[model samples]
Target: MTTKNVRPKFLNLFRIHLPVTGVVSFAHRVSGAVLVLSLPVVVFLFALSLHSEQGFERVSEILQCGWVRLLSLLVLWALFSHLFSGVRFLLLDLDIGMRLAAARASAWLVLALAALVLIALLMGVLL
Candidate 1:
């Protein structure tokens, strides 16, 4: 008798469906990485904005570019996503929202809150 192979030959990430909690957890990690990687640029821009009149003007001009504004929005979204998800994780550590339903609800809530923040940021920037 021969046995058939039980393992998948290839993994397809796009076909995988993750629960809301899993999505939130994954987003938290990704956002954290985004924030960490962007820190140097953020600090440099901040310092430049404070250096002198020319530096301030240069920083402003850099930020005025369309792509730069889009990147800023992305970075801001990452910031809020990391923050809200972190808080949800902390509460989970304390035994809150441990039930399946509650966990899913909280995950959706985190995503919604992050989205709301992004909207607010967009309005603030555009107006």
Candidate 2:
């Protein structure tokens, strides 16, 4: 077999484990994409409500529904995760947590911060 084909197969034979920082960095991109995709729907709904007084009332009532409230909570969680991770990346740009161990720890710390912020928001403590 040619070396090119053999190299790929050999690499695949081993289970590759990514460090936490790599995982967080990849997820940050994905979450940004999620935000981009979700933005239009969210903005459309907001615009629909703001177009008139009655439309505003209608949207307000719909928001009080359990499912709508749940979906809103989830969107808030996604927003927090993306925002916090972006801050971590900005810190990395400033020569912070570039070491393997520190990068991993910061990655986990950012994840924890996101979760804590979300939970606090859900509990009405932050709002």
Q: Model 1, range 1-127, lDDT digits (tens) per residue?
A: 9999999999899998999999999999999999999999999999999999999999999999999999988899999999999999999999999999999999999999999999988888779
Best by TM-score: 1
The stretch of ten residues in a row with the least summed lDDT in candidate 2 is 5-14
Candidate 1 Cα lDDT to native: 0.97
Q: Candidate 2: list runs displaced more than 4 Å.
A: 1-17, 125-127
- Per-candidate TM equals 0.94, 0.78
Best by lDDT: 1
User: What is each predicted model's overall lDDT from 0 to 1?
Assistant: 0.97, 0.82
**lDDT tens readout by residue for model 2, 37-87:** 779978987998989998899888988888878877777777888998998
Task: List clashing residue pairs in candidate 1.
Answer: none
Per-prediction CA RMSD (Å) = 1.7, 3.6
